[model samples]
Every structure is written in structure tokens, then in C-alpha cells.
Target chain A: MTFDWQYIVDALPHYKTALWLTVKLATIGIILAIIVGMVCSIIQYFKVKVLSQIVQVYLEVARNTPLLIQLFFLYYGLPKIGITLSGELCGIIGLTFLGGSYMAEAFRAGMEAVTKSQIETGKAIGLSNLQLMRYVIIPQAFSYSVPGFGANCIFLLKETSVFSGIAILELTNTTKNLMGIFYKTNEALLMLVIGYLIILLPLTLFLTWLERRVRHAEFGN
Target chain B: MLNSGISVLFEGVNMQRLLLGLLVTLRVALIAVVISIVMGILIGIIRTSKNKLVQIPFRLYLELFRIIPILVWLFVIYYVIPANFDLNLSAEVVALIVFSLWGTAEMSDIVRGSIISLPKHQAESSKALGLSVAQMYRYVLIPQATKRSIPPMINLITRMIKTTALLTMIGVVEVIKVGQQIIEVNNLDHPTISFWIYGFVFLLYFVICFPLSRFSRRLERKWAT
Candidate 1:
């Protein structure tokens, strides 16, 4: 078989729209994940004993299980319990919870990396725990943790495709629909691959740049 | 109705199907792990190579693989490649190829990081002992790197196994797919069986993954001490 340039051209317009959906899903999902992750990390850091253990278990279950099952649980299971959300909302919620768990771990690792002496010095200056964390601990931790956070963000961006299974009309779902519609399986799937790369490549590059900047800042040179 | 669900799980024929599905999952994961480890080691070496050109491409390849979701890659490989190239491969083959590509990229990064994190003096001292590059790597460098690499490598293996669930989308009858089939069969009369069937699938994955998870942590502790 030979490459069909005409097929690719014909599919390009459809792929453009799918690429937009993919970008929207990833961007919104990641922003939500970062916010949820920060909140969960803060709670995990400061909450009392039993609450901490509950948060820890939540993180473990979220991380250990497959995202597909979790998506199914939210999209299909929640309605059974008298709580219903749109498929898109369910997808975003699932991605946020899953992504947040990993991001929380990254934040925790970052917090742990803050030197004891530095925290002690902040306290010696008569800073309360909250002030010490807000002023001294968190800023330093964020710089050191940027690479891990960036990596998790990129992972979340890709993982948003799992939303396709729940009929979210994202890139993968669109590709599958187009394939069934046109029966031009090859062209449709090729456009899907291109669609994913179009969205992911730039984000990957940006994250790499961000990681480098953070590393440079951390090392002071 | 509940009895039938339990019997479907334990009936000789159905039990065989579940066991066969389990074996297929294990087989795919085991083969993928072996292939990935070998490719990972080679790419890891290339990534840390003194040659700038080689290192740059390897780095790009690693990042691309890591950034692309496994499900998307599975779709691209199992559906796109065969259709694009007109190569008629089985779904299992496609799944293996895609998973190995992804796993190798991850493992290579892990290997590269662990190797680089080693003290520079270790390599320098080996060179001072008049060892050739090949001897230095073979005798001095790799043994230490292998120990450092085991925990992450095991974690990667568990990940690959869990990831096999995605193969069901491409029509490979793994355990999750088997569960879906059971649900479909019982849907007409007992729609609630969907939960039990899927719940069983979850337990199956947990059984397979939890041990590997424990083993990974154990190896991590052992290596640390």
C-alpha cells in the first residue's frame, strides 16, 4: 500500500476540531487537578491523626487502581447512589482525583525535602507554623518540586484520553466515531495519532523548559 | 440470581475462561517486561552516551513515549499502524508492541537516572585501574546499576500488567473483557451482575498487582539498607 495524501487532507478538518476538544479537556482537567492536589496536600500535611490516615488511604486507593475503573465507578456508579453528573463532569472529576493523588505525593516529597535547619530558623525568627510554611517552606518546596509536578501534569494531559471511554467526545472518542462513520479506518486513525501529537508535543516541550528553569533556580546558577 | 453469578465464576468451563484470561494477561506482561528491560538498558546507555547527537534523540524519544498516554499509544499501534501499513497482525501482538515501546522508554529513563546518580569517582577509579570501557561497564558499572534499578524495574512491571486491561478495547479477551462478556450475558435478566462481574475483575487485578507492589517496596527497603 502507498501513502494517501488525499485521505490525510480530507480528514484534516475533522482532526482540527478533535484536537481542540483534546486541548480543552487536558487544560481544564489539569488545572482542576492542580487545585485539588494542593488542597489535598495541605490537608494531608496539617490534618490530625485519623484524618491524615484517611487521606493517606484515599491517596493509595486512587493511585493503585486503574483510572479506567475509577472512571467507570464515577460515571456509572455514582448515579446509582442518587448523585448524577454529566459525562464530561464525571471525566474531569475522575481525572482530577486520580491526578491529585499523584500530585499530592509529589508535593509531600517536595515538602519533606525542605531542610530541617531552614524550618527551624524560620521558627526561631518567631514565625508561627502557618507563616513558616507559607513564607519559607512552600516557596522553596515548589521550586524543587516543579519538575515532578510538570511531569505529573503531562501525564494527566495524556490520561485525559481515557475520558473517551465514557463517551466524552474527546479526540479518541471522535476518532472512533469518525472511523465508524466513514469506514476509512486508516485515515481516521492516522488523524487521531496526528491529533494527539499536535496537542502533546508543544506541551511536552513547554514542560521540559519549565523543568529546566526550575532546576536552574533551585541550584542558584 | 446470586447463586448463578457465583456459579458462573466457579463453573468448570467459566473458571477455565477466567484462568485462561489470567494466563494471557500474565503472558503478555511477562513477555513485555523482558523485551522492555532489554530495550530499556540499550536506550539507557544511548541516553547517557558521550555523543551529543545520540543523547538528544534518545531524550526526545523518552519524553515522547512518557508524554503520550498508554491508551492512546495502544490505539495508534493496534488500530492505526496495521491499517496504515496494511500489516495484518493480531491484537495481542499489537498490544505487546505498544506496551513494550512505552515500558522501554520509562525503564530507560529510570536506568539512566540511577546510573548517573552513581558517584563519578566509581567510574574514575575503574578507569584508573586501567580497565577498558567495555570491561569497566561490564564488570564494574552494571552490577551496581542492576541493584539500584530493581525496585523501579519491578514497579514498571506491575504497571505494565495493570495496563494490559486497556488491551480489551482492541478486542483481546483479557480478564476485564471476560468480565464484560459475563455482564453482557447476564444483562437481560440480572443487570446487577455487572457490578459483581466488574468487582471480581478488580479483585483479580488486585491479586496480581498487590504482590508485585509489596515486592517492589521490599526491594526498595532492602536496597536502601
Candidate 2:
């Protein structure tokens, strides 16, 4: 079969709109995930027994299952329970919860990597537990957490594509719609692949650069 | 309503359907894991090659796979590749190919990391003893890297399995799809089956993934000690 460059050229405008939507969802979802993840990680770290256990269970369920199910559960399952959110809202919420669970793990791992001696040193200087955490523990923990957190964010960005299943009109949804309209599955998909590469490559590079900068600063001479 | 939902989970046909779904889930995961391992080793080796031509292509391949989402890749293969290439492959075949490509990038990174993490002196000693490069890797370097890689690889396998749920979106008839179909059919009579069916699906995935998570931790501890 002959190749058609014009089809892809014509599809650029549609892909651009989808790309904007994908980036918006991913950014909003990631911001929400970071806030929720920080809260969950702090709850676990303090070890408030019952609440921590509840948080643990929630995280496990979210982490182990697929995001597709979680999205469907919210989109379709919730309407039965008298809770109706739009498909886009459901997609964002689903991604946030899933991303938050993984981010909590990242936060916990970072917090654990902070040496006890550092906290003790803070205490020796008469800093209270809250003061120490606010000033010493959290700062160091966040630095150590950056690499893993960045990786998780990249993963989350990629995962937002699944939102298309519920008809969220993101990048993947746009490609699917175009394919349906034009019946040029190949050209539409090819454009989608290129669109994703354009968006993701710079993000990945930035995260990698941030990771390297953090490592260097942490171990500076 | 809650009690009725609970009973449907235990009923015969629903149970049978869930079990079959679980089996297919495991099969897809197992096949993907095997494919990833083989591809990982090959790409990992190619990545470390001294040849600039070989290394550049392999590095580009890894980046492309890593940056793109698996779902997008799945869609490309399922809807785009066949039509583009004029090939008429089955959905399952497409899923496998897409997963393998994604897994290969991840596995290669793991392989490269573990191999480099080994003590430099070990390789130096092997070379000093006249071991060829291939022999050094085959007999000396690989065994240690494989052990280090296994735990993360197992974790990645669980990820691959959970991700198979995305195949349902493409009409793959996998476990999650089966649950969706059941919910659609039972919408009128068993309105609450949706929650229980998905809850059951969640539990099934947990049962499969939790052991791998535990095993990875245990291996990590053992290796550390």
C-alpha cells in the first residue's frame, strides 16, 4: 500500500488539541497525587495505629489493582451508588488516587532513607519533633525522594492514556476518534506515537536532569 | 443490597467466569514475563556493546519504549500497526508484542544497572586471569546480575499483569472485560453486582501481586544480609 504523508499532516491539529488535554490531565493529576501522597505518607510515618492500618489497606488496594478498573469503578460503578461524576472528572480522580498510592511509597522510602542521627542531632539542639520534621527531616527526605518521585510522575503521565477507555478525549481518545472517523487506523496511530514522543521526551529529559542535579548536590565535595 | 452483591460473587457461573478470567490474566502475564526476560538480556547486552552504531540504536530504542505509555503502545499495535502494515494479527498477539516491547526497555535498564553495580575488581580479576569478554560475562558476570535482577523483574511481572487490564479497552475479552460484561448483563436484576464483581477482581489481582511483593522484599533482605 502507498504511504500518505498528507493524512498525518492534516491530522496535526486534532493531535495538538488531544496533546493539550493529555498534558492538562497529567499535570493536574500529578499535583493532586503529590499533595495526597504527602498526607498519606505522613500518616503512615507517625504510626497512628488504626488510621495507619486503614491507609495501608487503601494504598495496597490502589497499588495492586489496575487503574482501568478504578476508572471504571468511579465512572460506572459510582452512578449506581448515587455518586455521579463526569467521565473526565472520574478519569482525573482515578489517576490521582493511583498515582498518590505510588507516590506515598516513594515518600515513605525517602523518609526512611533519612538517617536517625540527623533527627537526633536536631533534637540535641532543642528542636521539637514537629520542628525537626518541618526543618530537617522533610527537607532532606524531599531531596532524596526527588528521583523516585520524578520517575513515578513520568509513569503517571504515561498512564493517563488509559483514560481514553471512558471517553475522556485525551491524546489516546483523539487518536481513536480520528481512526473511527477516517478509518485510517495506521495514520492516526502513527501521528499519536509521534505526538506522545514529542510531549514525553522533554519531560523525561528534565526529570533525568533533576535527578542528576539532586544526586550531585547531595554528595557534593 | 450488600448481601445480594456478596452472594453473586460466590454463585457458580460468576465464579467460573472470574476463574477463567484469572487464568487468562496469568497466561498473559507469564508469556509477557518470559518474552521480557529474553529480550531484556539481548538488549542489555547490545546496550553495553562498544560499537557506537549498535549502542546508539539500542539506547534510542530503550528511550522510545520507556517514554511512551503502555496503553498508547497497545492501541498503536491493536489499531494502527496491523492496518498500517497490512497485517491482520489477533488482539492477543498484539497485546503480547506491545507488552514485550515495553518490558524489554524496563528489563534492559535493570540488567544494565545490576551489571554495572558489581565490583569493578571482579571483572578486572576475570580479565587478568585471561577470561575472554564473552566468557567473563557468561561464567562470571551474568550469574550475579541475574540474582540482583530477579526481584525487580518479579515486581515488573506483576505490573505487566495488572496492566493487561488495559487490553479490555481494545476488546481483548480479558478478566476486567468479563467483569464489565457481567455488570452490563446484570444491570437490571443485580444492580449492585458491579461493586462486588470489581471488588472480587481487585482481590484476585491482590492475591497474585501480594506474593510477588513479599517475595521481592524477602529476596532483598536475603541479598542484603
Candidate 3:
């Protein structure tokens, strides 16, 4: 079958709206993930007793299962227990739940790379525990984790495509609906791939550039 | 007791069907992982070459797979190709192709990184011993890189296994689909059946993946020293 540009043209408005929702959801999800991740990493880093154990369980549960099942659980499963969430909320929560574990691992890696000598030196200088964290550890840990954060951001954004599973009319869902309606599978799928590339390609390029810049800044090229 | 949510999963052949679905899921992942490992080693070795033409195309391939979500790739391959081409592939075949291709891209990069990160002396010493390039790779590079690549490759297998859940969207009768079917069949009598069914599905995945991840972590730690 010949490819039809007209169907794509007609579907442009839907794609635009879908793209906006995807971006908004992904942004909110990533920001929340950073917050959740930071807390978990800090708890684990400091070796908090019961809380660290909880975070460990959360990490394994989040990391091992697929986001699709997580979304299904949140959207379809939770209501039985008298807790109901909107589709968008389910998408955001699922993204955060998965992204948080990954982001925490990234942060943990960065934090662990901070040598014991540096901590000893900070203590020798009479820096308090809080001060050591604020002035000594956080900055270096964050800088070291710059590439990880960039990678996680791109990952979370690409994950937004799965948001459609929760009945969010994001790009994938919109494209699927159009294909079903018009029976124009080629046009719809083309637009769907292009729609994702349009969103993710530039973000990937920007992140790679940022990562390089951060590396150069950290260690003199 | 029979009307309870948990009972819904056990009613009739539902549990058996879910197990069958799990088999499909594992089948896809296992086949894809095998294909990915073999192809990934070849591509990984080639990727270490100093040829720009080869490098650029593989880089694009890697980026394309990285940036695009697998579900979108699933759609394009499952729907787009069949619509345009004369050939028709089953959903299982499509899932295999997409996962294998994605796995290969990821696996090759891991292999390439391991190979590139080898100490300079290993290559120099091998050359000094008058080993040909192919012999050097066969004896020196591949063996060492295999050790480094194993943990990440195990991680990749877990990822592919997790990713096989997306096949449900393509109408593959995977675990999620089977659970959904059971949930639908039991919906009239049991409204809360989804929670148990989906929970069971989650546990199924965990049972398979958790040990694998633990093993990978152990390997990483053991091999690091």
C-alpha cells in the first residue's frame, strides 16, 4: 500500500496533544523520581536501620518487574483496596516507582565513589556530619552522577510511551486508536515512530552533550 | 470462599493457563537472549574496529534502539512491516525479532566497552609474542571480554525477560494477557479479581528475575577484584 501523508497531516493535532501530555507526565515523573531516589540513596548510604531495609525491598520490587505490570497493578489492582487513582496519576506513580529505584542506584554509585579518605579528611578538619554531607559529599557525588541523571531522564521519557497502557491518550495510544479507526496502519505507525524520534532524538543528543560537558568540567581535558 | 478474589486465580484452568503464558514469555526471552549473545559477540568484535563507516552505522543503530521505546518498535515491526510487505509474521516471531535486535544492540555495546577497557599491555604483549590479530582476539581479547561481559549480559537477559511483558499489547498470549482473560471471565462474580491476578503475575516475574539479578550482582562483585 502507498504511504499517505494526508492521514499524518490530519492526525498532527492529536499527535501534538499526545506529545504534550507525554512530556508533562515524563517531567513530573522524573522530578518526583529524583526526590524519591535521593531519599533512598541517603538512607542506604547512612545505613539507616529499618528504613534502609524498606528501601532495599522497594528497589528489588521496582527493578525486577516490568513497568507494564506495575501500571496494571496501580490502575486496576489498587481500587479493590479502596484506593483509586486517575490514569495520569497511575502513570506518574508507576514511572516514579520504577525510576526511583534506578535513580537511587545511580546516586548510590556516585556516593560510593566518594573515597573514605575524603570523609576522614573532612572529619579531621572538624567538619560535622551534616557539614561533611552538605559541603563535601553532595557536590562531588552529584557531579559524578551527572551522566547517570542524564541517562535516567532519557529513560524515564522513553517510558512515557508505556503510559498509554493505563489508558492515557499519549502518543502511542493515540496512534493505536487512529490505526484502528482508519485502518491506516502504515501511516499511523510511521507517525508513531516519527513522533517518538521527534521527542527522544533531540533529548538524547542534548543529554550526551551535557554529559560530555560535565566530564570535561570535572576532569580537565 | 469460592467467590473470594484469590480463589478466582485458582478457578478452573486459570492457573494452568497463566503458567502456559509464562512459558510463552520465557520462550521469547530465552530465544532472543541466545540469538542476541551470538550476534552480539560478532558485532561487538567488529564494533572495536577502527573503521568509521562501520562505527557510524552501528552507533546510529544503537542510538535508534536506545532512544525509541521498545513498545513503539514493537508496533512498527508488528504492524507497519506487515502492512507494507508481502510477508506476515506471527506476534511471537515479531516479539522475538524486536527483543533480539534490541538485546543485540545493548549486548554489543557492553561487549565493546569490555574489549576497549582492556589494558594496553595485553594487546601489546600479544602482538610482541607474534600472534596474528585473529589469533590474538580468539585467545586474548574474546576470553577476557567474555568474563567482563557475562554479568552485564545476565542483566540484559533479565531486562529482556521483563520487557517481554510488552508483548501483551501486541495480542500475544503472555502472562498478562492470560491474567486479563481470567480477570474478565471472573469479573461478573468477582470484581476484585484483578488485584490478585495481577499480583500473582508480579510474583511470577519476581520469582524468575530476582535470583538472576542477585546472581548478576554476585558475579559483578566477585569479578571486580
Top model by DockQ, which number? 3
| CA displacement after TM-score superposition, residue A155 of candidate 1 (Å) | 0.7
Which residue segments of model 2 deviate by more than 4 Å? A1-10, A219-221, B10-12
TM-score of each: 0.90, 0.93, 0.97
Candidate of highest lDDT = 3
Specify the CAPRI tier of model 2: medium
> Could you give the TM-score of chain B for each candidate, in order?
0.94, 0.95, 0.97
- The local distance difference test score of each candidate is 0.78, 0.84, 0.90
In order of TM-score, best first, we have: 3, 2, 1
Compose the digit string of candidate 2's lDDT tens values, residues B178-198.
887778777778777887787
- Candidate 1 chain A: minimum summed lDDT over ten consecutive residues — where? A73-82
Q: What is the RMSD of candidate 1?
A: 2.8
Worst lDDT window (10 residues) for model 3 chain B?
B1-10
Candidate 1 ranges with C-alpha deviation above 4 Å: A1-10, A78-83, A216-221, B1-16, B84-86
